[model samples]
Target chain A: MNLLLSSFSSLTNKVLMALAGLFLVTFLGVHLGINLLLLNNDGGRAFTAAASFMGTNSIIKVFEIVLFAGFLLHIILGMMVSGQNKAARPSTYVVSNHSATAPFSKYMFHTGIIVFLFLLLHFFDFYFIKIGLVAPPDGIASHDFYSRTLLLFSTPWYSLLYIVCFVALGIHLNHAIQSAFQTLGLNHSKYMDAVKVIGSVYSLLITVGFSIVPLFILFYRH
Target chain B: MNFTLKIWRQKNAVAKGEMVTYAVSEISPDSSFFEMLDALNQQLITSGGDPVAFDHDCREGICGTCSLYINGRPHGPLKGVTTCQLHMRSFKDGDTIHIEPWRAKAFPIIRDLIVDRSALDKIIQAGGYVSVHTGGVPDANTIPVPHEKAESAMDAAACIGCGACVAACSNAAAMLFVGAKVSHLALLPQGKVEAAKRVQKMVACMDELGFGNCSNTYACEAECPKGISVVNIARMNRQFLAANLLSEREKVVNISL
Candidate 1:
């Protein structure tokens, strides 16, 4: 409707971006749950089975489309919002602003860019193989994600990059979960502390949970 | 206390500004920050130099007129106080203090440390009011308000519109100022009459004024002289969402009709 379109402003853009980000957050949890199956001690039999199910499921296929859409929308709107925010101050201050805000809050865009670059590397290692854009390494099937993940994490530099990216992802999500709630108008004084606590906990879980897999592969799996 | 001041100096709104250094000696630690500046101005006038221009009124914190980004902090190093109330005692002797105006596209420099904050006034003019008819004063307690709601409304009403929030924000956003105003009214029964329309119009005006979006950095809450909470911003966002999505509108008639 014209009335609806007329009301779409910066706030609306933020709300949409927050919704997309929250969607990606949920996807991260689901992905981590699936990835943790790599530690099943059955030589990745369980992990590969689950990865195949996720790759072939009809509903998940549709969700894959939505997931990519969410990522693109979140990235595009984030760029737009950051651009406008940068333009709001035409000149730099002689002295740096020293407000006692959370240190990571201002660097959301920076952390987000790091996470995005990591996502590209991750897709090249895994998703691109699944979609056949990149060929799987010799003797590994395209559906054998567990082997591919183990192969990637087995390299010291690759594991280091994975851990570093997970750290950046953690920092990004630390502010992001609560920020998304605030942007969506779901925040309140009564529960805002709880939201912040939950955000920190979730970010920690994702960072530790994912990083543990790489360490486990590199150290114990060998 | 002897101190060197690195103050922003500009001839007028259109002129380029720079950090102009000056030395002030024998300032009493008991003197307020503005008084120390007054002494510097006196010395400058005697020497036939232009006095640094800054905004101040009421000498106390209530007027919300005084503004300065001293040492990278709005209203100097103290928390929950304005520049007018900040004393020279907060700084050490021989310290060089940096002072500048609020930096934002919506707030242009008027002189040296004085910025034109009329963009805030424009936001207020958009819908930051109730459309009450002029009449005899209504009796108290005529429309009952819950105690908690009234308390919350008063807390939000403490915003001084000093533009410190805008200065403190990385994005130069005015959400805190506008949020405080919107929440201050939206919580009360008198303001409830036009709450939906008020939020919509005010937000439209804010976006058009070239102020940035709130990224939830919370620097506004930290640097606000009144210690206005970011909860008010959340309340504003809630009001804005409800207004745009749920508020029913009257049917529009064609001009010919």
Candidate 2:
């Protein structure tokens, strides 16, 4: 225990970061699935049903606790590692080259902060109302999650912010999935290419999947 | 070929350093990078000026002593070769090559382009050895090792500890250097007895020395003079995990008993 804690080995922090990141990846899929129900044109019926089920389900309630904990841990650890990385080089180079490093991967800290700020605004808009801290929009059912989403995305500025954040998410997820696997010691030359491919596809899916929603609301909301 | 050199200059460890530009002409294109530096130093001495200081030993690349950051790339633009092995032919006439010391918190500047890499020595002292009986060397075939495993271990063992990995890393991480050492020993049967303790101690020393965490940037593997693979880093991680679990199990058993 002393060795583990006292060492505070980068390996431990990295593995924990990767685990939390992968867990959050799963959460994104589920969250996106729930949010996509907004496209049901009949009404907010399907969205409301799904949101209500999630809001009321005991298992999901428990999972939400784990989800938030994972988020908190990942954010704190990411900052810690990033801070150390910065401190490791007290002096700046006059001419630095990073041709070997991935372009999108280099902006990890930037993308992470963008995604974090976006999460805060997103939670304030939706989760707060669902949890009763904030009131739902006028005349909409309290549990009509879809209508509330529509109300938020209907604002041009807000919809644009969502699109921008989803793009940042795409960049973050692109590097993160493969990075997590590499950190976990799951990398191999034979399959690393495949892992990177899967990462890009997954990132594209989540980014496009979530981005299309707000665009549809802004453009097609009749 | 003639060229201008922008070399980092510092009077002492505590002094602030800056790049000082110098010119050299009539340099033979076939000379090694250090030979070009030697010619410049001779000129500086003749002019009664302070000669630029740097580290080099056994002008052959194997010594791991000729550490240099030329034109923003460790060991210059070439791959899998140390600065000592880099010849002037790799550069063109009139190209101003920038030479700086390996920059990291653990590696402080001693003078000019020379840095104190003793911090890495401390990491090595922490575990980079197999404790065995002092006697006649054992027969090579005494320990039966799988061919592939032996080959992989040798590959890891090729790390020359040049600190180029630290200089090249975006995060200034030394994981590649430390990982190569750990995997090299951990793969061999002779090193198994102290494998767990070696990794733990080396890692503790590495963290304490102010090295950064590896973020999978892989700049270390790319800039490594020996071309040490990033796979060694993953192997080290696996070894660390197993060691920690084994130690934890042992502690639990002791307490229960």
Candidate 3:
């Protein structure tokens, strides 16, 4: 534990966050693919089946637990890192003639707060509602995932909110992916171009794809 | 153009500091930020008031001497630009600009807007030098470096020991600055002789100086006047990790075997 604390305590939060973020990135790919099912004219069992499979699989259950821990750890470490940073430089620049120092996503403890709030509402409206814990108001088909998403997506304001959060996710991912590689020491110029390209593409897709659902649902009733 | 300035004035290290407001009238927009400060100083001199003492030299932006916390940013609003490079045009007709020095516990205020950045010097003293001591100037081409590596090394070497990286950094971490220094020397063949020990000493010095950890923020890169890459930070980390693992293993082998 002393060895662990000595070496890992300082950067442990960042390491955990990078790993968890990568996990969520993979999860995003799968989740988005499943959500894309709702785009179908003849909405098949793909959405429900994928959801059901993810819901029941023992391995997935374990993964979910890790995922939850990852999210919490990420937040906890992020907060710690941010707090230390704040204490390190107690005074802000007076007439800051300088450009931004940290990447927007890099210095985003405050932005993460916004994202965390959005995630809470998202989990409650979708996951919690489906899991039977959330006692949705009468007349709302909270359990029907498709109907639930459609309902939220149908409203312009709700769709706008999703768009806003998705934009934040883009901001978050743009910084995190490259940073994760940096933390892991994969920042050589030889492969850095490829990493940067992949990071940008991945961030763009998550930002554009996630927001598209709400826009599509809002414009075209399904 | 007339401008109002809110400058941070600290009497000494022990004294608490605050922003003191001063207005400058009839200023040319073409004047550099420091030049403008000089003009303000001239005005103060005429009025028998204390001149605002800030650190600056080689006003050409190479020496990295000018340290000012200009309006909530390190060098002022221009991205990838330095205070010396900053012109009055960036300001409006009547702008209320706040100016302060780099604030950190290690960088205690010496006077108004000037703190002792010798902590940086000490870190450099610890390991920035090569183990190979020079007797005299040798044939330059003897230590051959690839054009790309040489250029990159020079670019990293461009770090003027400016605490801008620390000032710009929200974490106030000297990773980019230190990384640039470490990489500048580490990348070259001449400095490679001491590479194993160089990293360990520099990192130790950095920690001893009371700077924060990097936290993977690239703000230092963005704000670096020399455009030092945050990738240098990664290079530094890899070097440190390698030194710790391989050299320490060799040490344990000697003890046990």
Ranking by DockQ: 1, 2, 3
Instruction: Assess candidate 1 and give its lDDT.
Output: 0.92
Candidate 3 global CA lDDT score: 0.78
For model 1 chain A, where is the 10-residue window of minimal lDDT? A1-10
Q: Which residue pairs clash in candidate 1?
A: none
Kindly report the fnat of each predicted structure, to 2 decimals: 0.75, 0.63, 0.53
Q: For candidate 2, lDDT tens digit of each residue in B1-257?
A: 99999999989999998989999999998999999999999999999999889899999889899898898988999988999999999999889999999889999999998999998899999999988863576787877889988998999999989999999988888899999999899888888778899998998899999999988878888888888998998888888888887665445445554
Candidate number achieving the greatest TM-score relative to the actual structure: 1
Over B14-59, each residue of candidate 3 has an lDDT whose tens digit, in order, gives: 7878889999988899999988999999999999998998998888
Tell me the tens digit of each residue's lDDT in model 3 across A1-222. Answer: 223433443334455667777777777787788878767766646677777788889999998998887777677666666776667666555454344533575546766787888989989998888777897656776656766777777778888988998888888887778878887667987898798789889989988888777777777754
Across residues A23-86, which tens digit of lDDT does each residue of candidate 2 receive?
9999999988987888878687878888889888999999989999899889988888898899
The better-scoring model by DockQ among 2 and 3 is 2
lDDT tens per residue, model 1, B5-123: 99999999899999999999999999999999999999999999999999999998999999999999999898999999999999999999999999999999999999999999999
Between the candidate structures 1 and 3, which one is better when assessed by TM-score? 1
TM-score of 1: 0.96
Each candidate's B-chain TM-score, in sequence, is 0.96, 0.94, 0.92
TM-score of each: 0.96, 0.94, 0.81
